[model samples]
Target: MFTSQEKKGIFSLSLIFFFQMFGLFLILPVFSLLATEEVEGATPALVGLAMGSYGLTAALLQIPYGAWSDRIGRRPVITFGLLLFAFGSILAAMSSNIYWLILGRLLQGAGSMSSPIFALIADLTRPEVRARANAMMGGAVGLSFGSAMSLAPFLAHYIGLSGLFWVITVMSLCGLLLFWLAVPVPDQDPVKATQPIGVLLKKVLKQPNLTTLNFGAFACSMGLTATFFMLPMTLKANGWERSDWWEIYLSLLVAGGLVMVPSTIFAEVKNKFRQVMVGGILMILLSFALMAWAWSSRDFVWLMVALYLFFVAFNVFEPIFPSLVTRLSDAESKGTASGVYNFSRFAGQFAGGLTAGILYHNDLPFLPLVLGAAALWFLVRALGFPNPVRHASPVEKPE
Candidate 1:
């Protein structure tokens, strides 16, 4: 663990990451209801489009955003992106129509500097301690996610949906200002291996193992996006209030955190990377099947247990995959690989939402349909992955 004073800056960096994500996630549950007023003939598809458009924009921009961060410096590019994000938020907040909302979300997502943010972490931390820094970032993500889901609905009810967007805008601007004023420039520029983009792309994506990693990120995002669409609704049906669903998130994430520590240790120290990933994927698959079952019948306990299991799987795999990505590629292209991983995942988010909206539009149930398909698809992908752990692979390790 970093000393208290030393860790403060990173913690603040983590906080900046958290609020940016919070701004991203805050409208998820509230958007469908809000959309009825904003868009003419608003249907599930358009609603999904409005909701997910941000991720699509984020996906498209991440690679270039990453490269831009590399060229200039991390903070300047990130600040510009945040300003762009805030601009989008203000537009969304002031808009009365869905067209504006969609535009706002697209720009908002495009303005997100996910690659830049992670790049800053890469620039600041040593490789030996990088996993811990990455884990801290993951924790920020989880906390923001839980907090956003819990708070967004209540805030929407009281202040309206636009209010939530404005709040995020304010938060984003504040975060940007803090970064500009307080975060110091690193003592030295990040020394990086130079490679042509075409060559780097060929080397990383063409490698079978990293390709598997890309698919893994895809499956994980697809399954997560699809399944989470139903969980709150399921809880609502079981006499739980919509606002109270975060209790499950809070509880399960606690368990997930405890389990994650052991999983990371066992994977790294004991060098059981492949086995651990297999277990995480299997756990996710089981949770999907279980969620389907719970939804088929009104079984609250089963739903609760399945949610707990699902979050556990998410927490374990989220950090591991990125760390493993670091192992699978040259340092020159590690940033690029991370960008690809995020792009694939966000692409899944876009597809997952679009598909879920379509399935949900009909009388036949859809979250389960999409998630079940995603689960099976991922199981196949998991089977094809080569373990990236240094000790386990006979393949001449990641150079």
Candidate 2:
């Protein structure tokens, strides 16, 4: 359904996403342990800061990056972002202290490539095929997540966290090269804004449907980040070793992917967007509840079930959310809308990490965190998310 150039663009961008995400997620499983063991004067709060610092910078910079891409070009912005990312990776790798590590993570987040990359995909693909293109990209991210989970322990064991950072740096540089060589330049003219940034932001925010999806993105991310912040420690406390983590994550990821295929097809091809999304949200809520129970009871089997369900729900929503944003937005403001959407995502990441850190530092129960996630999901469902498939073709054109 895609032209050769479109195919190339999709594949190139997918690789860019894969490498970047892979590098970012590679440290998740071991970050808390590393902070306490290696870094000077590390505490739980500091560990959380290091873990989430990237999201803060990324959230703050995403809109600017997207706006700049509109002013200059996607390729230039993407190239610069990749370079920044690599620099951050190097900084992180060289860090001998937690403070420096936090700074490096902030720099990593400052790159904010997601907005421009999605905008570029919108530029390259037809609206009809945009969902498919996004699905491909999301699948790449899922694969990267799986690969990172499977590889992180081994890599950390063999070479240490510093070595992993170096590997991330190399991966980002590889992304830059792939983007330059593989992705074609867009033929479109520069975007001439019909309104100021404030007005544009207001307009996007005022779209009830878009706002619903944005909230969904935020809530989902918040749940994910918060869970991961505690999951590793909980697992360790329950007698699961770091070496065995890969097996659990790999198995869950594979199972999630297996279920994701049919769910995605049902949502996209069968035009059951709302049903699928609602189901996914419910699943997320249930997962959180189960997670809380498992954590409290130290039931390894139940914890695994909760994680598997979380992954399944996460994959279901990941691709659909971005495509929905693109579909709902006018072409003129796609970059802007995408920036806002991504901003929400990163903001959730920041909030989740910070909350997790504070709770862990205070030695509080995990029940609040899980309950908060459930509440957020309930709010998303109450917002009445519209079905993109119902309006897909007609809304593809910009207003």
Candidate 3:
């Protein structure tokens, strides 16, 4: 289904994505603890800030990075982004305080390469095979998330957070090496100046189909980050030692992946994209509801089931959402459209972290907030998502 060059592009890009995402996830299971315990003046809010500051920078820079890639080339932009990411990892590794850690995270996010990566995939693959390519990239991200969760606790137990950051720095450099060595350059740069920036942005934002998918991305990310902001501490309080987190996450993620694989195949191959997407959103809502119920019960089994559902739903949606965005996008402005989509996603990450932090600090309910957001997401999808096969079709120029 893919040419040799296409295979190289997918493999190299997937590796780039895996390394970057793994670096982020490697810290998620332990960063809050590190912030509160090791860093002086680290309040719950600061901990949340440290966890999410990267998203803020990523959200802000996504569009610019995408646009830059369109103007220059994907290789240079990605290389520069990787360099920045590595520098941030080094800074984070050396941080002595919470504030510095936050700065490091912000710098890490500043390397925003998601749009360019996806755009490059769109550049390389035929439309018929694009969804599969996207699924591969999404699978890379899901695998990285699972691997990080499984390894984080053990790594932290031995090398500590600083050492983990150093590891991330090394991994990022490896990604850079892979990018230069393995990924193919596009035969020709796609024309990006055909549409005015204002016009393209307006079109992308105004399309109901695109908007729905973008909102879904936002809600999914928001719920994931917000839940994690509180989950580690909650689990620890519920008698699960930090060392044991890997076991729970590994089991849930594996089960989730098992489900995700078939669902993705059903969506792409069977052409049930809309149905699968709706089912995925409903699954997310159900997961949040379960999480809300589990919060007060403090039952490890209940929490495990809730998270299992969450990961399943999340994995199902992650690949499909971006594929839909690419499919719905005008070929000319795919980079811009992807930028907007990623902006929505990371913006949600920033919001989720802030919301979780405030709720935690103020002694308010967090699960209910996540549940409400999930409910809202469901409503948006039910009312707005189209039923036509248009979303699964090849990319088209805007009318």
What ranges in model 2 sit over 4 Å off? 187-194, 361-383, 389-394, 397-399
Q: Could you give candidate 3's per-residue lDDT for residues 18-95 as a string of tens digits? A: 988898899888888877887768988888888888889998888777766666667788889999989999999999
Clashes of 2: 0
The lDDT of model 2 is: 0.80
Question: What is the alpha-carbon lDDT for the whole of candidate 3?
Answer: 0.79
- Candidate 1 error regions (>4 Å): 1-9, 37-40, 192-196, 235-239, 298-304, 361-366, 383-399
Strongest candidate by lDDT: 2
TM-score of each: 0.87, 0.93, 0.93
Model 3, residue pairs in steric clash: none
**Predicted structure 1: lDDT:** 0.71
Q: Candidate 1 or 2, higher lDDT?
A: 2
Task: Please give the distance, in angstroms, between residue 200's alpha carbon in candidate 3 and its true position after superposition.
Answer: 2.5
lDDT by residue (1-399, candidate 1, tens digit) is 564433655677888888788887677656666666545666767777776777788888776666555555677778889999999999889877777888888888878777777766655655445556767778888788778877876787788877888998988998897777765555556545366656656676787767776777777776666555555555555687656656766676588788777787787666666778788878887887786687677677986787678878877877677667666655466666667777777777777666666665354445765666765666676675664444432122542
Residues 1-399 of candidate 2: C-alpha lDDT, one tens digit per residue: 899878988998999899999998899888888777888878888888888888899988887777667666778888889899999999999998999999999989998699999989988887777778888998898899889998988888888888989999999999999988888876665364566777777877888777777777777787678768877887787788888999877886787778677787777787777888878877877787787676666677887788778777887878777887888987667777888889888987887788788775443446445545554655556446656545455355222
Query: What lDDT score goes with residue 189 in model 1?
Result: 69
**What are the Cα lDDT values of the candidates?**
0.71, 0.80, 0.79
Better of 1 and 3 by lDDT: 3
